[model samples]
Target: MRQINGQNSTSTIKQYSSTLLLMGSMLCSTHLLATTTATAYNANNYNAIQQTMLAEFALAYADTATALHNYTVLAIKSNSTTVKQRALNVALEQHDFKAALDIATHWVVQEPSDVPALFYLAHIALQAHEYELAAESIDKILSHDPSADLEKILAGIAPESKEDQTVLVDALQNSQAKDNPSILVIIAALEAQTGQFEQALATINRALKKRPNASNFILMKANLLSALGDEEQTRKWYSKASRQHKSNLEIRLAEVKYLIKVNDSMLALEKLEKILQKWPKAEEALFIAGLTSIDLKQYERAERYLVELRNSSQYQNDAYYYLALNAERKGHYETAKAYYRLVDGSLYAVSRQNLINIYTEQQRLNDALRFLTQERVNYPQHASFLYQAQAEILKKMGNKRAAIGLLEEAIQHLSDDPELIYAEVLLLDPFVQRDRLDQLLTLLLDLEPNHPAYLNAYAYTLALQNRRLDEARDYAERALEMAPDQASIMDTLGFVAYLQNDFSTAAKVLEQAYLLNDSVSIGVRYARALYMQGDLGRFAQILKQLQQKHPNDPQLAPLNSLLIPPPMPKSS
Candidate 1:
């Protein structure tokens, strides 16, 4: 009794004096006993025990249970501070937590050293997420328990070893708190992890009250806002976090991700450039920013970022891959190939393929062949690579036999592939016996009758043999149906018409094909049709040009002079 017997020292004592001159008996009364349990609130039921406390106190007897009953009786009688304290205790026992919270708050404002009251109030405040109130309540108890009691209380509430976690847990339990700064800090982490950005932002704001300038919190808040689709707010938070946490790499990276995802890749690039200007080896930042620029089709800018990162062996793989793509976009084949070689992975395969394509495009067929042949040693079953290379080489060297072997092998290995089918059909042409080659064309037509390659191959072969004009015309017309724009097939169609004596149609198809690829075969066929047309002057003119093209060719020279008048014995 002596330990907690004295009047409150200052403001609390003054509050009591203003209310009433102390009743000597009330002032000197024995302190209330402590109770162990806490209150729980129910939204549907309002606690009615505050209206019955005084009556219950007088009839109480027996143990703490009876004491609790008496306290409930006293609390029910009035809204007085003493009644409020009793109601707080009874409310805690009945688990009428909200009522206990209401009473505890009232008691604390009136009297700080009401120890049981302070303890109850702090607990309620903590549960209610009123962190500052909870802390204030507990601190007051410690302040008065001058004999190291506050430390003991806090130690007991949140054991020293796991205290931070406990404090955070305690803060979390107070879901309805008016302003719980501590709870906000921890929820910031929780919400970000779960992708619950909106709730996370509000929770983190509470933490900001505790640490207004905390960089991590600011960054987290910014990221959450971004996730919530609040870009302007997100930017504001990002800027604040960057300023507050100047050395925080994560904050800067977060801002970069936001800019990239929203298609504001130009801004992302500028930010990344600034970062690289400051810290040149930020690999992840540079790589992601480069990819963003690539997505935006800003190839030149993407290349600059990639080239800067290419200096380090660690980043070399990625740097080279991105740089190769950039060079490819610019049509710099050799430059692309140089960059492609440094990369390793499945991406390396794409790089090799792209390089092969560049060689074929430049008509450096031997280079394309050698690369794929080497690749085949390691990837022997790669049908497309093997066939593309073989086809290009054969087309250049005109080695019909060797080309046939490769085409047959490609067809056998990749029977369902359209590209390989096209290459295979091309090989069937230029053979001596049209019948032996015609069998392959019929097989291809059976496989895909509408396929232009199959149509053109069969039609052109029949026309050249001059043996089946009706079948040739049907095949050529079908090929024209699919790729009316294909010059090679157009020539076949024209020649078939000419063989059928449809000279008007032959001239039209030939002229169109001539304008398309300007192939020698089409030009000669057209000149022949012109001669048969009795347009001798035009026919003569065409032969003169053809002779210039064939120059010393024996077959064309006689044919050429026979058509044109010998250039006047002009010289003299």
Candidate 2:
């Protein structure tokens, strides 16, 4: 049986067993059985007692369906709230959402003030996708307790379910609680979470009118304006809110964050300085100030702020990481290494990667390899990534053969780790070792068939061979379906289209892909498609841009040849 909302099935069954025992004892009471007046009344009482006994018998034997049916009938016939609640629990335990909804609705109708029943009804309705019923139940809940946590109640709805959220939003708008500031706040938050910035802005304005000095609402308005692409208005609102709530640290910090987001590092630093002056020990403000100083290339100021936070429990690792970054920027290699070593927790992997990069940059390949080998032993959880890093360093040193061999060795010990396998597949020459590449891709697809990256790789490899265009297109389309926004997958699809001689479709998708990512490979493909479509103007424009941006890229050599004028005839 499935656990409901973290409630253990065994415990729920035990609770139901206890309830059945109590009901059994009540039904077996001699006094009640003998107190019947009319024959008809006694007959009905006998039937009820027999049904209760049967329900108890079914529950005792773990026959949940039988118990649920009897309990549901008993709950409807009797006005006992306890029976109704018991029936609802049985329905929930059996994973019968339909029955649970029915019982919960009946319970709420019988006892409108029952908060627990109302809560169950709301959640069950949401589970059934009955958004309007859920909204109505929520409105009832808020009517009883204005302080109800609507956010918590609505948290079960997936954030990506924008349609359901829209229905819920509309239902709430028509509710009697529409004017309630708390409800309006929740509505605005839902709207904002789903990217309805204009609607969110309007809803938040309504909430602010009800509670003008609400700091969270003010920040929401500013964020919504930012989302709506009105940066000027966003900046104005942030400034206005900061001035109005001068003592509110959260509002001030939000304004500082907005400034940093807009690349106004100097202004952000100034704001952080003011906040630090008042709340001198505010670690968050100090951290932001340190990062902002780094952005502005003020290393000394960054160090000053970061050093003060080195001992902070919450920001210690982050402070060390940034301090390492500061030292690295100033060419203090030893100091940077020492600070990086001090970094731990979530930043540890990043710090180690940076250390490896420094070694590679200084041409200390042996040292980088030694450090990675030791790190793999010290942090075994990161072994796969460390091996990949080692392979990258070897490949950078012009030993692609050794890199592939090392990955194969790693795979032997790690038992077919997909990352190592994929890394090795990428290192192989697709044209020379087509069969091996295909084999690895087939294995990868078997392991993770729906992985968009693997699908794109397989599709691109097939397209590169200029064979199996149909199969390649299928895989590319599947990958695009899984990750619609990924430009690389789109490029693969476009490449497949190009190989199939569908230049129109190829140009359309490749143009979008180039616009999204603009990698050298994607740009080349887009330029080729445009050229094939006879759009010489667009083709020339893209080719020129590619040459300017990537003059040394080998892929551009062919396109550059097209622009060369024919040699003049010597006879002329």
lDDT tens string, model 2, 1-572? Answer: 11124121212222445556456546644446567553424555566667777887798899988888988887777666556656777777687878878887887888788776677788778766787898789889887887554544555443358787788788888988888876787788888888778988999899889788877778878888998999899999999998989999999999999988888889889989999999999999999999889989999999999999999999999999999999999999879888987888889879988988888778899888888888888888878888999999999999999998888888888865788889988998889999989988998898899999989999999998999999999999999999999999999999999989999999999998999998999999999999899998899999999989998999999998877889988995
lDDT of 1 by residue, 1-572 (tens): 12321121111211222123124213322111112223434321122332232335432432445545544444444334544544454455455556656666656665656775676676666445456666666556655653222212222233223444445445445434324444355445545555556667778777677667655566667767877888788777776666666667777777878777777778877777777777777888778877877877888878877877877657777789889988888788788988876666556667776677777788787777777677667666565756766675776778777777787777777776666656655666445646647766777787888988788888888887887889989988988899989998889988999999988888788878878875566778877777776777877776777677776656565457555666767575
Among these predictions, the greatest lDDT belongs to 2
Work out the TM-score per prediction. 0.41, 0.64
What Cα-based lDDT does every candidate model obtain? 0.64, 0.83
TM-score of 2: 0.64
